[model samples]
Target: MRGGVRVERQLRRLRWKLTAMFTAVTVGCLLTLAAVTATLDRRAEERALDADLSTRTAAVALTACFDPAVGRITVDDDSADSLVLGRPYLVVVVDWSRDPAGAVVYPARAPLGPPDLGALRGLRPRVGPGDRPVLTDLAGPSGGWRAAVVAVPGEGPVNAGMVVLVGDPAPVREANAELTRRLLTGCVVLAQLAAVGGYWLARFSMRPVVQALTRQEQFLAEAAHELRTPLAALLLVARGGLAHPARRVDAMRDTVRLADRLGHLVTSLLTRARLQAGTQRVDLVSMRLDQLVEQVVEDLPGADAVAVRAAPTVVAGDPDLLAQAVRNLTENALRHGRPAAGAAPVEVTVRDGLVEVRDHGPGPHRVGHGSAGTGIGLSIVRWVAELHGGEFMLVEAPDGGALATLRLPGAAARPTRA
Candidate 1:
């Protein structure tokens, strides 16, 4: 019980570790993807903002006229106002030729307060490679601003004049912030789903390991139980032979029999272990099932007491395993089938890829009534039959006793002798 609890605890720990690993990997990947996506989106938004600023600056520049006679730059108020309306920008015509001051022609009143005139005077109307207005970021007491400066075509006062379109970048900033929030929210949701899926997958993967461990524990406990009785009996028999000189011969004979039984039990255990561990491969081959059965019967202790009626039954199977299964069945019948000392002989019949062992014993209930060994032989037989795509069954005989049947898949028919 303590071992089982320990195993369960270890399994639980392993499952949690696996789940954590899966969740961590998933979350890491999601965070990377979200970061990349946010970066791309921010760049796209900035590019769009710059494009709009340049277009608006060009439109404002077109409306401005430089009058050298008045030594001042004039802009069409209606056209500039129409462009600035419903937009988060203020249009200003800067006369660099003057005291670096300009007139704000649009919006009559600024929503985010007036423009920073000190900063505006520092602006230079520069064009890029394609004569595109150079946009610049301006810091002001009100907030952040993006400005595009385009020079009017004609000259007026000293330093000429330039159309400066100042835009409030609050909307762009808010949009980027919103996108970040959504990305974070999506990441959180996906991380939770990944954790849940990881846990479920861990549990699913550990199921088979748990079952195999449980089966191994059961097998070990049963094997120990089976070994204890015979070991005790052998020890007691050895002590009895030492104490009684007259029964020494009989005790020695009994010791030999017990040793043989122990040897058989050990062999059976080894075979089962090898089969389970896959160290011993079941090599399938075409062979005569009847011949195998006849060979097993001839090797038994009392071969004459086991009468065999076999036909030319051929099957595809591991010859060694099939022979062992037949031997186990015949031995089980010989040991448990007889009700009295002089009862009917155990009968083994092989026909049509089937081996039927019938005994004149009581029935299925009494088959292992007085047996000293654990019934692992029958289990071996069952395993072999299943491995060969066959079945093993123990049912009451029609007349009396028990009928044990081993059915195997038949091989293709062979050519008969001419």
Candidate 2:
């Protein structure tokens, strides 16, 4: 089974350190916001609970009525029944008073609700003029009572007496508490969402850096190949020159040419190294780009084969580097393509600050267009173009050959946008 099946594995595509940090920070902020919201909501709810308790307590105490016809104190059943039919309570004491032995229940009173009315003595609350009510936490066999006590007011002396206590279950408080729990849960969920979003955003934001790195690796590989080829050729030619009789002018001229070629190679290396090290200083100036191309065409390898097709196009830039890049392109085509290859008589055209090196040689159709010359020639051209913030394009010519085009902004061009 192992041998038959393809081992399918996925690699991590994101920078873990950056993504994790973004997630953590976002989640941390979300959690803090959630906690603050929960806290504020709970505080508002607590204030709400306090307000509700006041209203409810006042409603329960409204049962007091003065029986002026009998000159006695009593509770209005209609008012009390209005509270409930079998109203749930911890304890409801109809009569109570404070004494040395603590609160004692009056014998003539009635009791209702559960047996949790044990602590109905301490809840001091003002009910009316010189009359008070008490609310207590009562202990019980099963649970407890959050009780309220109030005095029944009388119009005359009819022994209408003091206390009336009532209580409800503790679960109402639990309901209020549950509201806070739900809010906290929502806050936690929001925090998790923020963490996930932040991670993806962090990864997306830094994608450019990853792309730059991948391209740099490819460029280094190509650069190594380019440098190796020229050095190899120079070494072979130098050894041959040393072994042969190089006393004649033609032989001396060949040696001089070899040294000059090597010098150009070294200069290219320095240009790249300086740019990489941030030591390359840009010298932007207003100049006629068309004139620059014409001058460069004059110095091209096998200058006789290069023909000017149009007038000069001007732009502002470092003229020397731009000229060198054009020269490199011409040299590459001349050195590689021969008389019979139909690549003869290279064409130079300039318009709108754009330079084109067109050849009638065997076209790039023989090799893929994407190949940046598996050699050093095109590398030097691209490096110079990129150094000046210019653009390059290589394409097969209509006449069974190839063309290299370079475009750069001149002094007359608009400023770069940030």
Candidate 3:
């Protein structure tokens, strides 16, 4: 995989993350709203049920005669026959020994056929006016019902009187069920729209960062081309100077010096290009960490205080990039460590998985401390460290200067493998 090309499988980016977050929150809100509304509807239904029970209690209470010996519930039969309850109502009077389902001695057929007596068996047998009504969710085959069963006048103690009851649920509850369904559907549609909006929000929010990266890419291409022109010019001037070195000794020296400086600049640019384009992967071979560090220190302009700790504490990594990282750190330390009185020598230490660069200059000026190498060196250090599953940190040096550390990962550098 190329270095700059970071492939995110989906959830790694902000758009999907926002969409998922909004969806979760929306579902939760809708479910809670549905639950609260359902509970309230049930409470209201009970109030309606109590009102129905009061009317039934009044009618049953006033009736004068129901004696077992007489075998008849005496009443104003003409008025009872003419009575009509607002909703579906059934008033059946079973024969003393008739099977509840087999024969309806006087089935009230005005409503939905004989009351679907399966409901009659379930009614409360003795509920007077003040008794709390027990309500439930089952509605009889007639679509709605609230029945109260009064005992027969004969069974005085246990089931003392005949059962008298009513039918149907309150109108409000029936309507509530339909209302809730409509609300939930509306919420689902709104949530889907919210998720789509969240995705676009994330996309537009990230536009500036994308634009900055594009500009950097373009700048690098132009800069590399510009540097090549000077490098070629210096090389040509060196060739002319070399052809007449006896007479142009000074010119020859200047030409070679310019060529060297140009060559160094070209290398740094290429490293940046390779890293940015995402195509720099290095093959590892057995090598000595102690030797590599020593070589980097030797190659530096100043290595007086460079020190190696532990035997070659090697690891698998891109040796070229690693060497470059160390050199950059050394140069950075030298550049920033020029003190009022020339600063003490910078120190380099390698131990465990870490390479520490410590200087005794008066730390960084406030301008540079924020991200440590808003410049080139720290950036390269940070990238190389993480690419190897390690890290880089800039800390206050115990003495005076800043401490830059690169902690890397890999097997310990050792002797050549068999």
Which of candidates 1 and 3 is the stronger one according to lDDT? 1
Name the lDDT value of residue 308 in candidate 1: 84
TM-score of each: 0.88, 0.67, 0.44
Positional deviation of residue 242's Cα in model 2 after best superposition, in angstroms: 5.0
Q: After superposition, how far is residue 51 of candidate 3 from its true place, in Å?
A: 7.1
Model 2: CA > 4 A from native: 1-14, 26-43, 59-62, 65-73, 84-115, 124-199, 241-285, 299-305, 316-321, 340-344, 366-391, 407-418
lDDT of 1 at 227: 76
Give residue 16's error in model 1 in angstroms.
Answer: 2.1
Q: After superposition, how far is residue 414 of candidate 2 from its true place, in Å?
A: 22
Per-residue accuracy of model 2 over 60-154 as CA lDDT, tens digit each? 45655555676544555555444434434321323322242332322223233334333433332333443434444556555654444455555
Give the candidate number with the greatest lDDT: 1
Report residue 92 deviation for candidate 2 (angstroms): 4.2
The lDDT per prediction is 0.79, 0.56, 0.59
Q: Model 1: runs farther than 4 Å from truth?
A: 125-130, 153-159, 340-345, 360-372, 398-400, 411-418
Error of 3 at 372 (Å): 28
